[model samples]
Target: MQCGFAAGSPCEVTCTRVTLPDLCGHLFLDWNFSFAGLIVEEGASEWQLRYAFYGDGDAGWVHVLVAAPLAEKTFPSIVKFVHAADWHEREAEDLFGIHFEGHPRLGDFILHDDAWQEGVEPMRRKFDPREAMRHRKPDEDWRPHRIVQEPGAFVMPVGPKYSGVTESVHFLLETVGEDVIRSTPRLFYKWRAIEKLAEGKSADEVLLLAERFAATTAFAHGLAFCQAAETVCGANVPPRAMTLRVFLAELERLRQHAGAIQEICESTALAVANAHAGICEEELLRISGEITGHRYLFGLLTLGGLLCDLANDACAKALEKSQKVLSQLNALEKHLRVSSSFLDRLEEVGIVPERTAMVYGLLGPIARASGMVRDLRRAQPYLGYENIQFDVPFEEEGDGYARLRILFAEARQSVRIMEQAVGALQSGNVRERIELRAGAALGWVEAPRGGAFHWVRLDGNGKVARYRIIPPSFANWHGFHLSVEKFAFQDFPIMLSTFDLSVAENDR
Candidate 1:
């Protein structure tokens, strides 16, 4: 698939060596027009690297998966693949210690909170993570990101720690007179070495580990982890389990979306709107607890099936609750649209251009808000989503208002999806463990934020030899940073509230 720059615009046909990474980007310049982003998975050894590229297409998502074994531990960096590969490549360097020979910025990223000592790569299987932490040493070469200082420019440090909704992230903003020149992100303060933790554990045990990585969408994470395990082992999930998984997952999405809207209102000082949306969020969580036995919907899924059959008429109850909450959400949205002050605060703030969002394949509501019609649930259906119908909403404006509108629209669709899934349920067995084979595969889902991807490598005994979890937060964090560039410093809180990111999820 080698293609070189014939003209400066697009490639003529297949060319030769892609060894020069710059050519990789220049070669796909046409693809970048529609290119979303890609997720990289290093195989059992350095023998192969599997990539799932959701690149250029009519919907801005040519969702396809392919694998290519590399000839060496080092492969040419694809910083040229898309404008956003810069961050993904750095992540590879931090986690697997892969050398991205020409990456502009390659150093400690997510694990920057003194989580590990210098020269320690926690995500690698051979390294003992505990030992890496015990041997922690300050990086001598680590220095504050250098940027050309404008007149009156000064470095402003926000936090690597917070006790509120935000996770542990240290933001170093270069600003002059309240105008941000650049925002440097220091993440992974809560990095628990998740991929390393999953190693050597059973698939069942891995579910528990994976769910904790992203607290808000625990069900989606659990489902993705189990799906990878099931796919590698050729296990079959029952019909009832499929429908139930969809139901619980939508419930998780509803709560997150509702909460996102509430925060957006709060960020604008719209206390009345926040109160109304906050009540809806609490109600959604209450009903989730009533059905799943956990507000986060944990402990309900297992490999091949579920922990147990869902409560009798659980579907009917969920539909009833969803309908009520949707009504409340509709009211809240109506109020928000007419609130001139609130709309003014959100409009044109934190604008993320369509090209930027598409380049990152920014997942979930964020990408949808940017007019990118790429929802994994629609593009690649899993867990009975094929039988359900709902609109994949998009907006031309990629601002805080657009994001807030997406939260409401997605919540409405989630209710519709759950209603259909509930009515389509049929009688079936729910639990049975399957004998797994030694292999590897990727599993993912339309998480609250975006797609939560889990790549699993099982050993001969069906034990996890390696695990990689890339949640939506990790993928979209860059998009958030990009949106805030040159924006006023005061807009930081508003932008952050609309992004509604889970730092715990990203830092992992």
Candidate 2:
């Protein structure tokens, strides 16, 4: 075992596979570091696992790396210490065929037993995408995992399929009566293997997939991906591009919050309020399309900077129109606040304690509502966020209402950010020439949902060697069960709406 980098400052430490779990335990309990993500990389004759952690202020990030030969497939599970690594380990085990020796739950995660055969290991380098067509063989004896042993206890399954354009995700709500005792979420029903497909692709090509993976937060993910590529290539974006990036990012954030608020209203059966919120979301989407040529802001990010420069007049006009939309949203929020029925559904529902949020490493609005204060834009400034003035809205209640308030507050802040960014826009080029070098770097952003991380390694040929994404959904989904359990089954949809998690991001 050898340390690859220094003691701090985005360091990486290499250790034996046997010692990995203990070392991670020290980092978690002793150091009080937050678990960020886990990535598995393929080597010529071995496989490497990289565990990412968020260190204290100025320490930035710390990564622990461990490798085992292909023949020695099993590795120790760190879930005994870092509870947040549960889903990451399960996903790795299912996709890479690298078993975790102590993982209590591994199989039937991303690949459902009813559709995909066991031992497919789609992420292995040797696996072919063409083989997917012939791999559909349902397991006749498969049953959903159950922990409730009482005779009256039963599982009420809610959706591997749902209506109205929602993606696939199954939740087993175990209850003996009206209250849910245990809630288990099963995601990644339509896993695209986007990271596996990114291998050998140019940085520009992979950027497309990153943004499209979660279309709702397209620009934020695209910006994170571009930053990773820019770091690997040693390219610096122009000042104008940085300001515009902030402008567009806030634009996306505002639109996303509006949509989330709409969903929350709909969940409470506030039809009139839902209609108002939906109108606000639609208006913002229109403004986004008018400014960026895409309602979702696709094709707007490139390796070095944005794909094209935005005119100051257009950006300013868009900001003004968006501000009007924010005003309407604020009015709707004010009305909903006074509506006792609406308040009853959200005020005390789906509570996630501050301690539970931190233990699970929750992100974005979910973390903020729980009083975690883990916004990456403020903690680690990027894209000129340090130069901009905006507040990170948070609430202490950690309830459904708290999350909803965070969305409303954040939407207002987004408008303020865009206003500042538009006024500070510089006159210069938006793109820069890149010299793609063989290196790995992490790019991150305080996306609307929360902090998103993108890790990229480029080969000497200027193609991506490995691309790993830790979207906010992937982080927050791990903790979704915390809010669902102990609550009545009637509160399920309301709680789910407040989380505003994206299934597409998780499936990627």
Candidate 3:
């Protein structure tokens, strides 16, 4: 399949597949025939290609791919795709010294430029850590660009702290009176250098790190990372492990969706609806915690199989809880929808049209809200989701309200899936013990946000030679800019909080 945009646009830009004399190339190419933009970064033996297309508004979409040299023994390259996907690409350039040719603006997306010496780049392979430690002064020139500025425009900065405790991230809101004209999210407050730190770690050790990439999406990331490791190692997980993995993945989805819906209610100022959603979320989390020791369902996955077996009693208990929560959530959703105030605030607010969604390549609830039916779980069934039946919720409105409704519907479907999966659990060895060999693998899992992909290459000693992770947040980050366009300033907080994007996930 030709990987192209789905919004009736054709990509005509093609690069010359030639050998590079130097380690990197930096140049920006503009497409004459389409609204697409191409950023090409040349490595020692590969070229990283990023395809970017502008949407109807200020938003854009980007897809990344690496063209490797015909010869073997070349280092696998890293390419950042979306215009808003800055942190990942910046990390890639910093670590590998690969230049982003046509990047409109590229600097240290994660590490502040002011944090290093005048000419030193800390992420390069040859960069010394001792020197960085010797000269640790905040870079005075590290001032981020303010995106929106006009007459009567004022800034409303939110977070780095909030009324409710959550991850720390700063949002720079550009407002004209009550309407939000532009919004920029300042992330990297919780940079954990996950990929760079994983270098040379054993496959098993790296799997643990992958699981911790995101507390909420631990199982999904672990599954994707392990599957990639298994692919490279040529290890085969048993059917029972695969089945259990599927069940756990869906369970994670249910919990996350429930929490997101609750957050939506909170954003809408519906205290009663928010409280009910919160209760449902707690129930889902408790069920997951009971089944797997971790409340977020972490550590349930291994390279070749699950860490342990799924208990029938635990499955039954989780299913029963889900059944009860579903009934209550349904009733609450109905009431919230009927409330005029809630509907008035949400409906058509932060509207992202279908065309805009495609341009930004929005995923999960954000994409579904725009009428795009692209779910990796359904489109490419990696786990046992192929056998399980469920509907992918979609809406044409593409507004905050539509996103809320879609999340509600997905939560109900997730419960139905859990019910079916719990009944299907049978007595068997839930794990397959096998020795992993040396190679490379690719693993993908449909996280609550969207698709999470992991590419892992192992050395002869079964250690990770290279690892790359693409979380769903990397795809949906651009939607923030799209949603804030043409909305009132006060609506910025509600719009941003509605998406509930994880900066940790993106920065990692």
Candidate 4:
């Protein structure tokens, strides 16, 4: 049954009390899972609240929900889980007014305008929305990850706006001579409280919002959102629809990978390569528009199936476009590989060790490039992925070069997947008529960047009581500093390009 109904609804998540955060480690070790989230939820009674620790597992996600009876203001921290917990926990402290006892840093993460007004948690319902949106005071400048100066080194701040990618993210690079001593990223400038805005939307309307989560992976995000709704509603997507969805998703992967590959070329100053890759990318988007009627395939996915069937000639054009894009990418890959100077700029520039990748739970090509084979497409086969035969290309280099190669390899694989999926389409209904009732479900898709996770809770009327979307970049962004460690100052742009992360995705 739907255990809880909204804020103050009994938590649908199973509650297990851990009076001490230390005990969480015992359960964590026994369960063999990693921390996915930590949050403080307003309890049914005003005298209490809850601190839930989410653990992601293969069987299903399990959360240890700790109830705090308002007798305590400070709760234990899980930074010991890994440094990754630091970000999520800090977010909890900032937005929920909950304090973490041992968190190394517990200040403004996503919420602050120069500084938060004393005694008011913007996320709390009691807080005035007008105050939250109040005009910034003169001389009050908000800088997310303010740069720290190194005694003998100079600190350089890169965009909260970088060329090529339209997002806000600040990067602090400390340089001594030509080598970078350190790098720190400040994000969330694009934060629109997407989850908060989605709270009252119907399940169908939320699908549209999901597609806007990240422009780079619109289709991937939409598919994940739909999957969660479908799961909760027990809607069986027909085989033909599933196959068509697969085609659309893979097409998105090819396009995004091409665009990222092009960005890398821009950073490396390969004008010719960048132009050609851009052309390939545009062609892919054009193909998507032809088949799904939206360049990003935004309107194509629905609760039970696609909004409609692919046009009769859609498959033919998709195949032709994919083949063309694949050939262009192959040529670009060859050019970069043979260019000694280009290869030199990329090789060993930014190396994130395999151990570090796993410790931080890195995702997508970043993890794959570091010798971690954790692509969910193969590991947790969702949708029609289990029906398709494809390869997930990985590399051991863990450097800019390896990341570039991985992008190219993954794009090639996307092309192969699209071709196979197109060939597998059969005649069947494309949409299933089902009602979204009160329930909750978790769904995810291996987006081009990495695994995008969506958790949805529907009210009795099928309106979204809650929806949390964690784009892959949200997890992948943490490992960025590790990749750039000990790299030269001039390589910063190139290294960043290799990752091609979307600050908007993480910021949202």
Candidate 5:
């Protein structure tokens, strides 16, 4: 059934409350079990109650908040009803401080303990950051630890520095013989607080910060942030810009996925496959630079529309290069798939089941590799993706091999999308001058990792009020825990790298 809520309302009240089984049944019918949970987000004030219905899919999840004051007495039952939505409830409790009476695990989801005083809610609107900082100290207790072991257990640590020149992240692996007992990831080493710094900047300025959230997915972040800003201003982008945005977004996917597949090859000691994949990635990056003047495709998107129009000839040249690069990459991927050594390392390593993926709300390639058919580009269409045709890849094995194959398949699909988008590109105005308005809006884009979300609110004078960015890395971090449970210590690096979790994106 279609929701009857109007566009302008902050919340919509759904009188019907179904049991978990019935809710799951409804989700299966409509969104196809993409998401299966309920949550509650209270208003800023003490008395206002709002409930949210959250659903998960292989691609991403959706949240719809209902307007109504939640009865304090009923909060416990509500919390228990959606036990699978622990992270969501914990986040709501931490930010809004709306107690989930029966919540099994409720604590700070992101904030360090020293970052906020005990019993003080750091994310609430009324909490003063300066005052909180006064009481805060750097949390040195943020190190990773493993389980106590008998004779067979071993501990392995991978990187504050890695083999490749990449961002800094560390993984702690615990194993007994060849089976991994636990894996713990340590993040926040690259925390920039981009959301906090964006407080007083103009929407345009925040767009710059958004682009830097991740080097690989820069265009994706810029696109999502710009869409949020445009939504807030009620500005409509020109069709040409929209088409170009889709083109760049797919291009970003191609580059990132190519890099991922190459890394997987390198991990499995397949030198030939790795070299071939690396060459394809460099070519993809070069094509990005040819099309947008930046290898990473940053600064192409702005608040109203594109920073500048694309040259038609440049677009054509980039398309031709991409087609050639993709063909070569496809041949290499097929060869790697048949290689016994590579298959041996990936086939059953770092397995994450469909049920666990759902509990952790894995997104993008990770969730797709686990037999989940979720693709935000298809599920919640934006940036002309609704008009474009593509398939959501899925793997039933849910192992390192599955994730690797998914990335390879997605790279091919992204190339297909780029080809179509480039063919349809028209020579026309790329931007429409839009007047800024003081309002709030939500924007989301399917970044290479998963869904990158931006919530932008503008002040009366056209300045940013509050900017909340929830990158895919933050949501998928839970998958690390789920995947590491039964894997061996040596497999941790491959498993971790397979997800390609971006610490910079998560820390921001």
Candidate 6:
């Protein structure tokens, strides 16, 4: 049934597989909605594919559901109309063996062909993890696909393995000369299947998995999961708890942006700038540890609210230290702007056009850097963000410098938000007792890199039945190649550092 929807309420409509693409196009292109994420779930006899969307300004969410029969598990691909569904379609196909009829590419997505067998379908009901592990075989005939096919063109494989603490992600940079003509990223080298693991587990058990999946953005993901669970159980959070949630969220954002700036500085060989940014990042981590008792703010978020109430003095102290760090970040930004060498490498290199960002559904800072002013905190205010006063920083240039400026701007704004949240703190219960019930809901947050969406469904026993995470890195990774393409090979790392996407987030 189709119904009028409010900003937070979802209006879901059931449609046949035949009219799936047209309906998706109608809602997305004609109605002007942003493709949020595609969620696929297996039922008793059929597969349900839900196409989720969110709109700007006063608009609400619209979900299109298509049921593909088990006899012939197939559905018309919506990638031709909505380009953002590319990776999502591939992931569903890989895990469930549900073929998207017109999908251009489908195999070797989460389950890499070189490592996993062809028809394992780990997400299927009949499949067993131990059984699959006992009989493992790598596809020896596997070869990386190439797009650039000129006389002197050759593909340079970067890595599924790299030096330092970087996660495994192979990059196929196809080039004819000095310029990279095509760039293909092969991620999910370490797919932990967190979603698959969440099946049948209680909400509390799954919360632990959610936070650990992406350590860098732990609080954001954990909070999102908690929000979904709270919504499912119809739990109400106290105003003070809501205020603290925003405060902690901004703290994570502040630290993440500082780390991003540090990486960008290191990428451009700015030794002093790198050290200064790193120092700021370390200080923020220390502050996080002092406040939440965890360096990454884990073990703090629960079903309806926070695990513990933060003392007023602790909040004040953290805010003061964060303000000093912001000032240092501002000084660093000013110095980098005057540095000609840094500007030359970042100014126009790796540009993602505004239209491309919109079509690809780029989220968070990456989308904002391209002049797309879509932030969930402001657009769909949640967790007391509606009461907070701050600006959603954006840039029209969409270059490396634009991305860098966004990081700094957002970091400053995060401090401003933290101040407001801390000043408004009240003495009360930080958490509400929530009795779990069977339901499904979507929870979202504007993380440091971009918007992170978590869709969760609970069984009758209050255990997780279906869990889907669409992290900012996963959404932004699609458009990452657009920036790398046509840019010189020398600017690759600099361009990548600007995005600051998490490989661990994608692998999950």
User: For this target, which candidate reaches the highest TM-score against the unseen true structure?
Assistant: 6
Scored against the true structure, residue 491 in model 2 reaches a CA lDDT of: 93
Model 5 stretches with alpha carbons more than 4 Å out: 1-4, 7-11, 14-63, 66-84, 92-99, 114-122, 126-166, 170-178
- Model 6 lDDT per residue over 76-166, tens place: 8999989889999999899988888899988978877777656878888777655647334665676898777789999888887754666
TM-score of 2: 0.96
Candidate 5 structure quality by residue, lDDT tens digits, 1-508: 2244444323233332333334433444344444323333234433333232333323233343333354442334243433335555565565556665656666645554546566665555566655535557667665444474678777767766865776776667676667767776656667666766787788788888999878779988888888888887888888888888888888889899988888888777778888898999998988888778899987788777798998877877888888898889879877887888778888887888887776566778998899867677886677778788788889998999899888979987887898888888876788888888887666778899987777777888788877777778877875677776776656666777788788888778
Error of 6 at 16 (Å): 1.9
Model 4 clashing residue pairs (backbone): none
Q: Least lDDT summed over 10 consecutive residues: which range in candidate 2? A: 1-10
lDDT for residue 377 in candidate 4, whole number 0-100 = 75
Question: Between prediction 2 and prediction 6, which has the larger TM-score?
Answer: 6
Q: Arrange candidates by lDDT, highest first: which order?
A: 6, 2, 1, 4, 5, 3
Q: What does the lDDT read for residue 44 in candidate 4?
A: 48
Q: 2 or 5: which has the higher TM-score?
A: 2
In order, the Cα lDDT scores of the candidates are 0.75, 0.88, 0.68, 0.75, 0.71, 0.89
lDDT of 4: 0.75
In order of TM-score, best first, we have 6, 2, 4, 1, 5, 3
Instruction: Please identify model 2 stretches exceeding 4 Å from their true place.
Output: 1-9, 139-141
Reference-based lDDT, residue 351, model 5? 86
The residue-by-residue lDDT of candidate 3 on 1-508, one tens digit each, is 1345535222323333232211112211122111122233334565554433322211222333446452322332212223333444455555554554544555655555656444554444445444425545766554556766687767777776865867777777777777667777766778777776786788889988898978788888888898778766667788777767777887888888888888878877889888999998898888888878888887778878888887778778878887888889889888987899988888888888987676565667788889978676676566678788899999898888888888888888887787777777766787766676776545667788886777676778878766777777876775678888788765766787678687778778
Candidate 6 error regions (>4 Å): 4-8, 130-136, 139-141
TM-scores, all models, native as reference: 0.89, 0.96, 0.83, 0.89, 0.84, 0.97
Worst 10 residues of 5 by lDDT: 50-59
TM-score of 6: 0.97
